[model samples]
Target: MNTYHIDAYKDDIYTCVRSRCGFCFHACPVFLSKGFETYTSRGKCMIMKAFLEGKLPASQGLADRFALCTTCGYCTSVCDVDRPEIFNAFREDLRDAGYTIHRHDEIKETVEKQHSPYGSPDESLASRFAWKIDHGSPLLYYAGCTARYRERAIAEAMMMVLPSFDFLEEAMCCGSVLYRTGYRDDAMRQARALVSRIERYSTVVTTCAGCYKTLTRDYPVMGLQIRPEVLHSTQYLVREYKEGRLALSPVGKGTKVTYHDPCHLGRGTGEYDAPRILLEAMGYEVIEMEHAREMALCCGAGGGLKSINDTMATRIGSMRMDEAKRTGASLLVTACPFCVRNLRDAGGSELDVVDITELIAQSARHEK
Candidate 1:
């Protein structure tokens, strides 16, 4: 059945192993945090090579090492070779070999039962969409799990800025968590369900970067396709502002703001300009952090790492927050709900972290 999709990357994996290039070393969040070669992309590739060559057997220890990665695709952005695809395939192989993390399993089970990875009490899909408004516009807002559950403020902000859009009352987990955690079958199942629900819309707008990337990038990779055009809220807002459909009251001059590029939005989907464009349009002085855009540091909540190793995830997020603090910006803004949650959790009261939509909504209220 060619389950792992590893055969196609066999040659590339060999080339990477032979080159022994360290280009992706500093790019990995886990490796940068732990200072271990085994946590880097190159290190993960080496382990996969050994497994493919039958030099090592699958073990819990090996699985644990693989689980450390956030899979933020920073290495893929920098690597001369395609490392993300190979790494994803390696994860599939690990799962197929019956090696899976317990937290990931629990998440998958929760998703299967409750249509959410949060493992919260069962709630009707309608309850999640209680805030939904059907403006009868072709655009539909798919507020992914984190935004709908953990961070309702992001969704509320989106509702404030968007003129008229339908909410995906049938929306479930976008399976981003499952896909990154190596539950391919479960992820595909969720993807199929989401695709079916969104087929009626002409365009799908996502407030969550993970949902945006999953719908636009990961679903197609899994051979599941949605007919509607998908846009991140920032992308949609930028387009609206550019087209003169959306207006924003300018922030006070010299209001310094810095942006964090969520890995899924930046490295995963090649969207580095939209959020910045929106911020600049709002008359805020946008400062660049040391790692912004393509080289942006992960917020450390991705790839089920937050679920598996929260302490490590928070440590990485705190480091990124430190970088933001160094920018001397009064506010840190990002496009992803997951990034907002993780960065806020790590930054605490030291830094103000907000989603772009929240800022936009605030600007709109100021115009009143």
Candidate 2:
């Protein structure tokens, strides 16, 4: 067995180290916040190269540097190298070498015990939304950890807009943070457990970009084939609107709002238009930020960075918030609940931050 995950990507690591194109530098959220080439994808590739060449040993300091990444994949957007995959593999190698970050280790433990990194939810979903659930419905609404625990309103909004759907009685973690933080084995175990519970559903919809990406992309890559079709809430809602099965009541009434594409949903899954379409349908004039869609900046909360180094994460999020403000929009809307939480933390009272589903719930007239 290959003890080091990076061994599978030796050639790719060498390619990044040799190219040294710096295409991934200025746009890297960690690099932008830390002002260090070591935080850039190429710079990290150089570190991996050094490790492979036996020049650098795995150490606590090295692990901390690797943990700073948001895994946003912006580097891969500009270049041929799959930087996020390589970086994640390198993190696994570091973890196996006993250089794991403390917070990440705690999270792994929490997820193993509680099925969540955010701890037990303050309230039970079954108690809160039991009346709205249809247990026999083919469609299931999966409220991911952050939505169920931290941003309850996003889940509530999704329930208000969705018609005839069943919900998981309790929110599950989905192992996104574990997978991103170098606990792939633990993540796989969690994935298998969650997969067994939801495979009966024909479709699983969620308001979290992180959970959508994990279930649709990462789970399969980890060799756990999910049976249900996974759709981000934006994708599901837009389809209903386009098919004339859903109605919107012009809640925005021409108010200008800018959309921020979540990294996992946009760069990870190639979903760029659904959220914007839904926003426009609800009567909001959409403004394009300087960095929107493919080139959009990360909200700085993904890949366990928020738990590891919150100050740096908030600084990077504040930068994205500034970009939204420059567009002169009154509200900043996004599809993912995680994006809303981090951007809100960074922006504070400066501008309103909302999930697309939240805005949709306000405008929905439930034509069906």
Candidate 3:
């Protein structure tokens, strides 16, 4: 029996455990999938409480249970009082206990040697948009780890859209993988190096929602200030709209698409509008999955989960694919390459998953 008590780190989450049980369970994908108290937000909260109070034995099971948590914070969104950052703290608790999974080790190895989780940043450094670079260009494009290896089409699409961006001369490692896993020292060190390389740029744009969020939102803590007018691709698309530069044809009668909200891009950073707006501009008759926007479900591959616990990430991603399939969409579109890759991996047997960039670039026109 897992005896549950409140831990000091979990104290931030204490307010949501109300006895009235008002939490809307049907809204949570994790709860729907697991159908248990231990996996539900309330259930996990109770478990953390018991562990903190010394009511439950700290064991291997504890690691699995905590690892099962997606840290999505849907529960906190519904709570009368919110403590959305608790899962991060709880993850730290697990790590402090020497309970990290194997991917953590692999990622650390990549960061230590290659400065990226993908293990190679060289081939990925090439940009189709390099021709746009001029002396003292104000814009730098940041291609995240997955984009460097698996999703070049997205970068290619943005290159087609934004004409004045420069790729980083230095590999462009943002160190988000370190920050998420509580490797504060490495994250800071790696982040400083990235910041120093970009000191010349007045703005930076990224195709990766994770890199955009981490650089713009978290890098300031180290006094590196990754805050150079950062724009996620969609935000740049909306800017294109304002500039009257992006052109689109209608959905052409048969094409239907749905959007998958990347957690960091949507809920974490409040960026649901730009991606959807871009899709709308492209004339996609956008249908939505059950969860969308700030309340949207994660595609289940962010926060280094795909590296650490791939089976769980795949399972969750498969479930997300099923939800997208439910919409009868001909194609599923997303912004994050990680989300695109994970969801495509999920639906490769049965559905089509692609980056919004790839979908758009297929028909995007170049100025004559």
Query: Residue 123 deviation, candidate 1, in Å?
Result: 6.6
Best-fitting candidate, scored by lDDT: 2
Number of clashing pairs, model 1? 0
For residues 108-171, could you state the per-residue lDDT of candidate 3 as single tens digits? 7788788778776656335444577554678877777778667777877776666566776545
Candidate 1 on 124-234: residue-level lDDT in tens?
533544555665768888878988778888988887776667875543888888888777888999889888878889989998998998889888889987899999999
Query: Candidate 3: which stretches are off by over 4 Å?
Result: 1-11, 18-24, 80-84, 122-129, 220-224, 249-254, 363-368
Q: Cα deviation in Å at residue 171, candidate 1? A: 4.6
lDDT ranking, high to low: 2, 1, 3
Residue clash pairs of candidate 1: none
The better candidate by TM-score, 1 or 2, is 2
- Tens-place lDDT per residue, model 2, 206-259, is 999999999998887888898888999999988888888899889988699999
Prediction 3 TM-score vs. true: 0.86
TM-score of 1: 0.94
Q: Which stretches of candidate 2 lie over 4 Å from their true place?
A: 1-3
**Residue 41 Cα positional deviation in candidate 2, in Å, after optimal superposition:** 0.3
Please report how far candidate 2 places residue 54 from its true position, in Å.
0.8
Per-candidate RMSD, Å:
2.5, 1.3, 3.8
lDDT of 1: 0.83
